[model samples]
Target: MWTTTPHIAALSVPTTDPSNTKCYTTKHLITGNRTSTQSEQQLPTYSNASQRSILLATARVIIFNPDNGLQATLNALIDQGSEATIVSEHVVQSLHLTRTSIAGVGQGLSLADPQYYRPKRVDLIIGVDLMAQIILPGIKVGAPNEPIAQNTQLGWILSGRTQPPREATHVVCHQAVLDTESLLKQFCEVESVPERRLNTAEDVWCETFFQQTHKRQPTGRYMVRLPLKTIFDPSMTLGKSHQIALNRYLQLERRLTKTPEAWQRYSDGIKEYFKLNQLAPATTSERQSTTVSDSQHHCSSCVLPHHAVYKEESLSTKLRIVFDASANTSNGRSLNDILCVGPTLQNDMSAVILNWRQYRYAFTADIQRMYRCIDVHPEDSEYQRI
Candidate 1:
């Protein structure tokens, strides 16, 4: 059953860290109270307050501890006042850490006097982004009809908040891939794209997200459908079958005569294409039937559904072909209805762009007529007849 309501889906992509990224994983042992620990497992530490914030940091936190790392209990609290993770000055100085800078996010570094003795207290303040990363037993981090923003609003209203110590300094930490609600909102809504360019927008968004979240280079053999042999092997326009001859194209010349201004350059382009490769005439009268049985057959014929749109100043022109591969000739199926479209595998464009940025220079090329260059297998030519 289907409903008319539009369904929304969100995928929270996990960030990948660098090989050298300083991070650690620690799990809490069930220990009662600060004094009641009888087992070897370390009990999960809590802030001075008993109740946890809506945005709670659980599991092992990957932190930057300057002095060979230290074991301490960090607090998790919900803060409606600020989106950044806030830490005390003592934690900053004790660790003597040089933090990474996140541009455009508010002033995150704030200083405050230590009010109470807490373990590993101030080196890093884990808030919303970091909290969302951790998944606890009872609560589903990502749930139905649950907006994190709404949760933060309701979280602050319902949960207890640990007040920052007096004279506390506020600092918003930044790394390339740390997940945040603001980042998601900004990525999806800020840019306005035309309806025709929605795919382009999606491509750009994926690329940005990949750059932000991933650090290490990808390693492993890619199981791409295109084989090394096929890619490296030059495409052939002519197979062994000398029986078939390349069809001569006159439509472009006919169209060019009507528009004399763009005729010379466009004509030259047409000639060059003819010399370089072979394209069979769609209306070739040699009348062939490669169509599967029980289908109406269509003869190749020429019609004025295509054009050579050109620029008057430069005489640059692009020839367009309008294909009616699905037309019902006495048979029911079309060329498109029978031929295989093959696989649809595309690399993450964003990841490609991200890796390109590491180099001092970058370049791109758009090869035209790529499909026509690939030679179909000799045996398969019959099925491919168009």
Candidate 2:
């Protein structure tokens, strides 16, 4: 028997006499006595799944009113893509929603594609209604020769948005929703060593190691070991250095117990130490190095020395370039010549390099590292140099 309420739907199967009315709600009559309920509050109230399906299947052509705010127009497109609604920037601003700037101008473009164009900052909103008017206005359906191409437009669809409707105003089960539910259930069922057990084992290991070496009193209850080197040499094992760090951390944790603020400082210090040495926690996907080889390199003509190098290296090693202090100037020379060898080296060097690439071609002629080496020239000095 299936029963539905405004807040819940209940399904039950009788185990006793099939025709008995009293056995319907009786807990003992059902196997496992399970009652399943579907709640109106839990289910979406969209007109129907079919309507949503139609909306997703139908390609929308948006016509922008340039006279209106450009940001509003872009926001409408983004909102529609994500939430299945079209909205304008003015509406977003009026609602006072937070807006983030687009990181780059051209978002969906291949490195080799010449026709790729990136837009300036585009505002995003959630919901189909927000973009419906922008992309599927009555005028767009009548115009056939417009520049819109389905391939390019489809890529503009944001992945983060809700699953598209199969049809407008109708509801249908989406494969994505089913897959996501299965994944969540699988995750919940997975079992691993509990954090408490791991922490206890680590504590025991440190305690035994410390007692064997240091004759001093082991007064602290908790212990932590900090690695000295970022990269652990295969031949090397935990030695006196590790023991000493463990003792220091235990002592610090003990001393800071009285002051909450000092405890935070101690915790921060430990994290910073690990981060600086690159000996932090390990993630599920271990860090790997990847490299690629190519015969040709392309340089951007818009900016001086804006080029990428083609190199052959192991797939495990990643290839990146970093500019040195010399290339960090306003000088007109291309900074592309300066390259750092590895990821760690690039990150460390980036802090020292001040000058950066600009959009204008004229700015590319400025001396590199102009900030560090060049000084403001006096009238007399300028005339003498000239």
Candidate 3:
């Protein structure tokens, strides 16, 4: 039969007699969206003309040792007729379960033959020994002392894995209990990568630091700066992403420059953005525009290429300029060609969602022109000059 548990979808096949049962659980890795009607056509079916099946029980058990405070969830294939509980190799490493080796893989073992195992890719076979650690709830069930026959078909799933000759281990199943209250503990935390923080004082420093520069220095006007070139050594080639961005920018520029209506809207957006942030030097005249090489930044006075993405659902102009700071130079150095001796920071979505779940009524707040408003150091401005 077919049915689903909280964590898995499973099918149970009953033999000629209904008293004994065998169950197998499988989880799909499908992404995107589809309806049941569409999925029914794509789902695989057994070819042996197997007898009709019924869904059976599945155990989503969380195993742990209370004394040492170790815990993890195990989605097991519940086979009552099978002699003992088996654990997959991934479980041992992922959940840190303890195990011991008893036998080596051989011709008689599951997925042991190179010809069969190569195609099947069977890495770990959980034997009866792991029954010692299969933490079940209060349900009591009979355990058979039957030994697994050689050359039996077996399958297993892990979070994810790669590399052949799968590494596996067998944990001792102490006892299967109905619940984990006495043995397992649960906890959660957020892991955000470190990122650059804006210097609060530097936010307003330009109006404060007005030295008479050798050139382009007007006493009263605030100095606009070019952001510093990122010092980075790219270990990877741009592949097709750079070309895609370049094409996108070219398309955006072509439409904006040729279509007066499109150009008017785009220019209007730029004007408003510049007016609000006071960042535009002089409403970029044709004289200020510079041509850049498609392959690299060869323009004597390069302006960072720009691009836009449209949101059809929105009425406001979603037009935005892309700052290709990572574009490679003739020497193969992009803005980020150097390394920052610091930890990176990024928000942890899981933790954010967890914290958000605790509240009811909520609202989102955003800063307008957040990145454009940040000021860079004066000495490093030449590198960012367009």
Top candidate on TM-score is 3
Residue 190 accuracy (lDDT) in model 1? 45
Stretches of model 3 off by over 4 angstroms after superposition: 1-252, 257-259, 273-302, 315-317, 339-342
Which digits, one per residue and each the tens of the lDDT, describe model 1 over residues 45-158? 233344432222222233457566753444333333445665444455556655554543322222121222233222344456545544333432233322132232213211
**Candidate 2 residue-wise lDDT, 158-257, digit = tens:** 1211233343587788564358888887786553222222334434544454345332224322221221111233222111111222233345446667
Assess each prediction's global lDDT (C-alpha) against the native.
0.32, 0.26, 0.35
Q: What local lDDT does model 3 show for residue 314?
A: 63
Lowest lDDT block of 10, candidate 2: 24-33
| 1-386: candidate 3 lDDT, tens digit per residue | 11110010112233576434232211111011010343211111111124321222233456675656777754443343445455556556765667877443322112212222222222233444553344333432322321122212222211111223435888876875565653343221124433445644432332233232223334332333321123122332222122333344556667778867667766675466445542323222212333334554332222233444445466554554334444454445443332121222345556667678899976888655444443333333323322
lDDT score of model 1? 0.32
Candidate with better lDDT, 1 vs 2: 1
Model 2 alpha-carbon drift over 4 Å, by segment: 1-235, 240-243, 264-386
**Which candidate has the top score in lDDT?**
3
